[model samples]
Target: MESEKYNADLSRFHGMIENLPCGFFIAQAQKPYRLLYANDEMLRLFDCRDLRDFCRYIEQDVRNIVAVNDRERVEREIGHDLQAKSDRFEHVRSHLFTRESRIRYADISGRLVGTEEFGPVFYCTLQEIDIPQPGQMVDRDIRDYVVGHLDEAIANQWIQVYYQPVIRTLTGELCGMEALARWVDPHVGFLSPAAFIPVLEQVRLIYRLDSFVLEEACRIMRQRMDEGLPITPVSVNLSRYDFDLMDVCQVLEQTRQKYSLPRDFLHVEITESALAQDSAVMHQTIDRLREEGYEVWLDDFGSGYSSLNILKDYNIDLIKLDMGFLRTFTDASRSIVTAVITMAKELGIKTLAEGVETKEHADFLASIGCGRQQGYFYGKPQPIGGTLAHIESEGRGIEPRKWCHYYDVASMFIRQTDRACALFDRYGDGHVHCLYANKTYGEQVHELGYQLQDIEEDLGRPETAEVVRTFWAYVDRSRKSGQMETYFYIDGGDYVNTALQVVCEMNQHLLIYVEIQNLSQSNAGRRQSKLDENLRYLYTMFEDVYLVHI
Candidate 1:
């Protein structure tokens, strides 16, 4: 839209924002950063008596309210936002000192507004966090340290890029790596991304940090090729904040061009929460990013709300399934994972399962045809140069152990193949107990007029001793090798063929899955079995994986 039209639409915006709960203000988009307007809330926020006092106090300079040490970084960030002509709202958190010398931590969100008369202005809001205890106000200290040292860190090379490997699930090939930012401070020692990234984002210093990581990732990819070192496409995380502060596509494109990297040499991972805030704008940005040759991935896909809507509406290259889902490794989680993967697949998008810490999770994902797996099981994220060296010497690391138990196998098979299935737990050299049995398996058990668990006591009987021995032996081997075991047993003069799969969960408990195939010399029974198989696969397919779009 043209500036005049935008101005007409926003003509009432200035007044409308005054009704908002938080502090609101407008200032010159460019330096010397004179305040053009301030709402009553803003006055109260600064502990000013009124507009006149607020104006006279700051001398028209916005920096006066900003703590002295943060002025340079704030200026740099705002300057960049202005130069970029950013249209999106930039959330910048920092300390705004009051007239009474009290410090207030403010989360300031702003965007440049074009006006017919003023040319352009910075329209912003301020939200203050609580005051700290005596001498416990370390937020400012950390903010100062980061902003003060960030430039030097970049120049003197304290900020480093780390690469965590992403493995192809089916073949366990090193498919890709995510570029993580790490700070090895000269005075403070090692600062994980968790430590300084939030501080940087709060202070709106993430642009510098994110840009550095992107360029460095591209450079490392190019350098690795030049050095004959093995390399894969590196994914660099772009903050949702990036869209507000500057033109993310332009920044990334320029960096990619500088490194002369291929279109797919670098990828982008955006968290689900970031996209949820403003789906329309984010969708456009993602589409533009993809159009510019960058593959956009929805990182931590199932970690938030409206995920199904994101998949349906946004055109993304891949979805990184959040590792938190696998923390339970429960039936519901497994079903949900299947649902997500299946949904993504149907939408012509790929799935990358994150946090494959255990061999079980990796194997489960692989068996279900998940495209990629990334977690500590493969390799922890490490420094770029060190990772390159390690990969050169060790190759893409070893294959993850495959541990598919009976339940894992049945969960996959019964849902896909439509075989009658039940689960049982073995006691200390005594009871062979049935925990739960599926519908088809329950039909056979119902014919014997006994509950599933009731069959356990019979396992000790002379007639059932053979089946018990075979089942327990198989359970032991299945747990060790992480593979399924098969055996046949006699129950009431009937031959029941079964496959037992054992899965060891996080709690160190074993779940034994039994798949039963009813074999009899009756055509009617064989026909019934075929019907069960066909109809079961269809029901389980939809049951195991249901697409959720809203």
Candidate 2:
């Protein structure tokens, strides 16, 4: 009698489930996922003719219900959700495959239940959903699509890495490249970063995208090297979420090592706003990247409120001036940019101006001493192949000569000092080139009754020939002895105290730092004191200062 009552109660329960409005089913938890039961609504949802057809359509396996493209992700997500909750229930959104080979977006909710017949099974309910049209898609729609299709997009080459050339301002040579991501989605057409990046961040999937970009950049670099093409450092942008989601430094190091590329070949760029969040992770990431020989550039600088604060707190190698300054080119804007470049130079941080569309903008930036530039005026972002072809045609793909570093180092020192300082380069032609002169150096030249232009135009002029020879002699002595040398000479009856130090020497190329002190009416004691002070300062800066008695 008790058995009959139990059977009657079970039948009633099944009948009620079969009439439920939504689809309901039960399947084994383990692989091969044999379906134990499916209600009438469930059969209809899959467009099956009957129970037999439903069984055949899904191969009697619950896993087959999900579209093959989405099966792995759905399973992984469901597993994660179930493991994270003590209730053993999970809710996921995925694509389902119907009997007619149609794809349906679905909302699935399931619970893990144990039964005597099946060790463990999922009692699930699924509801078909309508995806909004691209024109009407909201954030949620975009989010779902991105999350579902990101892997596919990466696998299918829908995501392409574009390179924008970074040019050295002084020489207009290609100094580096910035790797930017451009997505050409097959389903929705071209998706700008504005369309998908924020969605990815909100869904915590940005790290995957960033990692993909890093890998692509490394591959391009390796390919370029293999082809015997000149390559400059390629910078990959990292979102703030990257630090929170994964070990950013480890990923970068691994990617670089995987290609056997030098650390300098790949650079890292983080937005100014990202750094403004100011977390310990961000600080550590910057420090570690720099320590590992990678240059860390602060991208989109001045876009955020804490630009100066970030500069003070973080050790950034370069600052990419925001494009907004160029968009609204005005006297006020120019002044602001000039101040920023000057400040950055003084802080020993290099500056690059972006959005340079006109020659006027480029010329202004170069005049203000911005070290690098990137804009349509130079070259728009292009795919690796396009970039290579453009570079080849323009004949600007060659790497900067090793002697450039000498000028860079000397410029850094000269910019930091208020005293008159200049960089002099002498090649095999024996012509001394005043490669750079700071404002103070130019002013000092004027005070000595010689035009700065004249000196720079012809350092070999008869008027300055004697002094130039003396300066070269000191430079040679400093080079041969590997020590700093000083000389005092009279030019136009003015007592000029000078210090000549060889900054760098490569074969016939010699880079010298010239510090000029005009002690025209000063006494012997004053001249000696000034020279001592200059030597002390040089020693403090470079730790290699020696006074040689002639």
Top model number, lDDT? 2
User: Each model's number of backbone clashes?
Assistant: 4, 0
Q: Which ten residues in a row have the lowest lDDT in candidate 2?
A: 1-10
Candidate 2 global lDDT: 0.75
Task: Identify the candidate with maximal TM-score.
Answer: 2
TM per model? 0.50, 0.61
Off by over 4 Å in 2: 1-141, 392-397, 401-404, 410-422, 428-434, 437-465, 476-501, 506-508, 513-550
Given candidate 2, what's the lDDT at residue 533?
60
Candidate 1 regions with alpha-carbon error over 4 angstroms: 1-140, 388-525, 528-550
lDDT of 1 by residue, 1-550 (tens): 1322332344544544537788877777667877777777878867788777887778878667676655644544454344344453455546566776555666677887776666677788877655445454333355677878999998878988888887765445566789998776655444445557888888887988999988888888788779876567789998888888888888988988888887776789998888877656677788898988788999988778878877767788889997678677899988888877777766767778876766788778855657778876675578866654655565654332232122222233323224567655554455465644556677766664666666667654525566666666777788888887766444564445667777544334456777766554235547567644554466546644222336
lDDT, model 2, position 180: 90
Question: What is the clash count of model 2?
Answer: 0
> What is candidate 2's TM-score against the reference?
0.61
Per-residue CA lDDT of candidate 2, range 1-550, in tens? 2222332344423323545677777778898788777777777767787777888887778888887756755765575457556436555666665676444567788878766755777878887666436454233355677788999999999998999888876556787889999876655544557557988999899999999999999998898789987778898999999999999999999999999998878878999989999999999989999998888999989987999999999999989996578657889898899888889877888788887766788777765677778876676678977876776677774445464465455445444356688777777666667767777778878888887667755655434576666666787799888777777765665567788788787767777878887875445636577664665567458834444666
